[model samples]
Target: MIAEIIPQSSALTKKYTNFYITNLLILKNMGQVLGMISAVLILSAIYFRVGGQKNFSNGLFIVGIIGEILFIAIMIMAIFD
Candidate 1:
């Protein structure tokens, strides 16, 4: 009975561990991509502002802020996961 139970529990643990690791990896990648996108958006916004495109710059800045927030959230989740 002990031997049978041990193997079953170990198998379940391994399965869950793999799933957890996979999720963490996905979150990490998403965070990295969001960070890059946010950086580009912010830079583009700055460029637009300098070029006298106030409306476009403001829109880009808002989107960039949202992306940055998402990136931070994902990174926090990955860290605590």
Candidate 2:
């Protein structure tokens, strides 16, 4: 009885652990990609602003800030999940 229970519990733990790790990995990758996009947008926004395209620069800046927020949220979720 004891041996049977131990094996069953261990199997379940292993399965769930794998699932958690996989989810964290996916989230981490997603966050990384979003971070990169945000960085590019911010840099372009600065370049455009310097080049005298105020309107377009503002739009890009807003989008980049939002992307940065989303990336942070995803990273937090990955940690808690």
Best by TM-score: 1
**All-Cα superposition RMSD per candidate:** 5.8, 5.8
Q: Which stretches of candidate 2 lie over 4 Å from their true place?
A: 1-10
Residue 18 deviation, candidate 1, in Å?
0.9
Residue-pair clashes per candidate: 0, 0
Q: What's model 1's lDDT at 41?
A: 100
Computed on alpha carbons, the lDDT of every model, listed in order, comes to 0.86, 0.87
Looking at model 1, the pairs that clash are none
Q: If scored against the real structure, what TM-score would every candidate get?
A: 0.86, 0.81
Model 2, range 1-81, lDDT digits (tens) per residue?
222334445677667666767878998999999999998999999999999999999999999999999999999888766
